[model samples]
Target: MGSSWLPEDAEGKTLALVLGCGAAVLLLLVVVVVVWTRRRRRKPFDISLEDINNDPISVKSAPTSRTPSPKLPKRLSCPDAFQFPKQSLLVRSMTVDRVPDFTLPPERVQPRANGEKGANTTPLQYQQSLIGSLQPDLYSHSSSFSEEEDNYLPMSTYGRLWYSIVYDAAVEQLNVTLIKVKDLPGRGSHRFPRDPYVKIFLLPDDRTCRTSKVRKRTLSPIFNENFVFQVSEDDIKNRVLRFSVYDVDKRKVRHSLGHVIVPLRDVDLGHVDTYWSDLEPMTQALSSLGEIQMSLCYNPQTEKIKIGVMKARNLKHADFDQDTRFYLRVQLFYGRKIHRTKRTGSRGASVEMDMNESLSFSVAGKQMDSCRLEAALMMTAQRNGGMLTHDVEYGRVVMGPFMYARGEELIHWQEMQAQPRVPITRWHALTSNVSHD
Candidate 1:
């Protein structure tokens, strides 16, 4: 019984001894750890310049703006805050200056990695070098051109107007027929386009007397129009018939293209009553505003002239006071005037009147061979007192001392002075754009 008991007891005692040894070892380790922790807590770790220099593994420290430590404590590898010394001659001798993929402008320095420049130069030293390399080519090139020459001079000469003149001796009227204006400039030059029209006036009167219908978007325009001017055959030489060409663009801007001035004296009335004139620059002429048919009758007994202004047709329409109601004003070459004769809402207007007033009757008291009968079509707003102002210029027309629609010599003065007859009627051409002084 004793032997059997002893085997179990021995095993138990052996297990107890192993457990006691492990407990003793654990207690000893805790005591050693507590003691070491207390000693480390009492003295803080520190680093110093002397320790750094003395160490075989020299570490580059950051700026000394931080407080310097007393002495360096042993570290696991090296503190990240310090720059470690090169371990081998390979790192010390080798240098790298990497090239960039893109080129920089000459004035600007190429920036690099590690914030280092062409050399191992300090950052401030590299910045100073950049100022010395800066150049001034940009400002130098910009200062060489003129501001005004870049404008205005590029636009130059264009082609001209050709026109002719005629005189009707039976009725004694000076007539200008704009046969056609040809050979004007062309459009291939990438130039500002010309919306060309011709305007004419008989001067010492700069007043614009008439304008041809504007021919749009062409460099060359053709207009066949007839214009008449009342002049004594002797007084014709003193007159200059002026023609002006213009570029009209109602959406953008308008400007004069050129002008041609032809003197009546320059034209030979005997064999050559009609000829072409060259168009030039800077000056121009006048027109009657529209077309009308009229009859003239002179009673030799009363010494009075009756002008039957039958009606106007193909009239240029105008809007004054933003509406199209119009009345008429008639005048003679000697400044004799007839006012407020008729009013009409249609573009075709009718104005008939007889003159009982004073008449200088050209070639005084003689048969009126040719006289300018001017009809100024006017407008008056209902809101205004119908008073005509100098600013109002709508349309104008001029008729002759001729038969209404007969196209024959019809000045009543000539018929009455020669042989009294019944009144004859004829259609008269009218021109427009009469400017008021």
Candidate 2:
């Protein structure tokens, strides 16, 4: 109020002063920022390639394939190089003579794995023990052999039946041939004739005769249905045949016929056969003739398996259209046991279990001469009722067959000495590089 100036002029002058101060501050800030940025960009660095190289920090390179070095001796870490002898040291000293004198031939006395013959109580026992049990009526069929025969046959006076012989030469394999008898017995009204229409079955044992009989039908006296069987191979010098015959007409069955021994020459494996080792025995039982081949092999150097085969032929008569099952029945030991002793002797000799353990071979989906098959092994054991259920897991382990692979198609007892191979170590990097900043 002392210097009464116009309110508008005073206000305008104050606004101008404030605006000018702000503009000056902004200009100073812009200049300082520009100077600082320039100094930073132009500054000299003390770092050098040699200084960085002193540290020698190398960048790792990608891996590349390389021919692996030969495996070192046992002194080095090489599991594959470690080999097991053909025969175990612990059991090597033991000889056949040391075996019990009362033992029976392995073939004649089936292994416990094959349950009691003709007595089928095992399946019933298994069913009862299994979690999902089968109904008793499922297998319940109480038809006696006598009753079965009576129902199937209608008793009638004997008729003059016409018998025609047709040899399916293409389908039949002739191990032995019995030509039709030149002279026929005079027709007579005699029941069950003395010769009983004797038919000379050129039998080479159950396998040969059974294979032959299955393909043909004959009741002729010239054919010996009761012809004793024989197998004569030099290596396999003798084979005793024992089997039963069923008198279906008489409704009678007899087992354990006297043994028939036959001699044979040793077959040269190299020239004759093909062996499938990796395959399961059960597979052999089901395969077709064209597809299946009798295989053989031997491996002396165990680290890398080796094998040879002999005698491979097509099946003459196939039971099933396709073969899916197979079996290997090796007659490794032959002997008999005397009464009173559970043991047996050479005459009552059985298979040498150790020798069987040494045998190895392989099988594949397709025909293959030599192939490496992968293997995995595990053993299952049980606690005989003598042990407690809670301690069963820790009970004494009864080792079973060594498994090579797992799952539904698992194979057992695959020969480790002669088996597939695998790489033990990984590839290594070769190039070394460095990065600079």
Compare the candidates by TM-score and give the number of the best one: 1
Every model: Cα RMSD to truth = 29.7, 39.4
Provide TM-scores for the models: 0.29, 0.15
Candidate 2 has its poorest 10 consecutive residues by lDDT at 428-437
lDDT of 1 by residue, 105-182 (tens): 765445566744466665677877776567554322222224353344333354545465767676778777675555
> C-alpha displacement of 343 in model 1, angstroms?
42
- Residue 18 lDDT (model 2): 96
Superposed model 2: Cα runs more than 4 Å off: 1-174, 180-220, 223-247, 252-437
What lDDT does each candidate get? 0.54, 0.27
Model 1, position 152: C-alpha lDDT score: 40
How close to the true structure is residue 170 of candidate 1, measured as C-alpha lDDT?
69
lDDT of 2 by residue, 23-68 (tens): 9999999999999988888753545656666744422133335564
Q: What TM value does model 1 have? A: 0.29
Highest lDDT, which number? 1
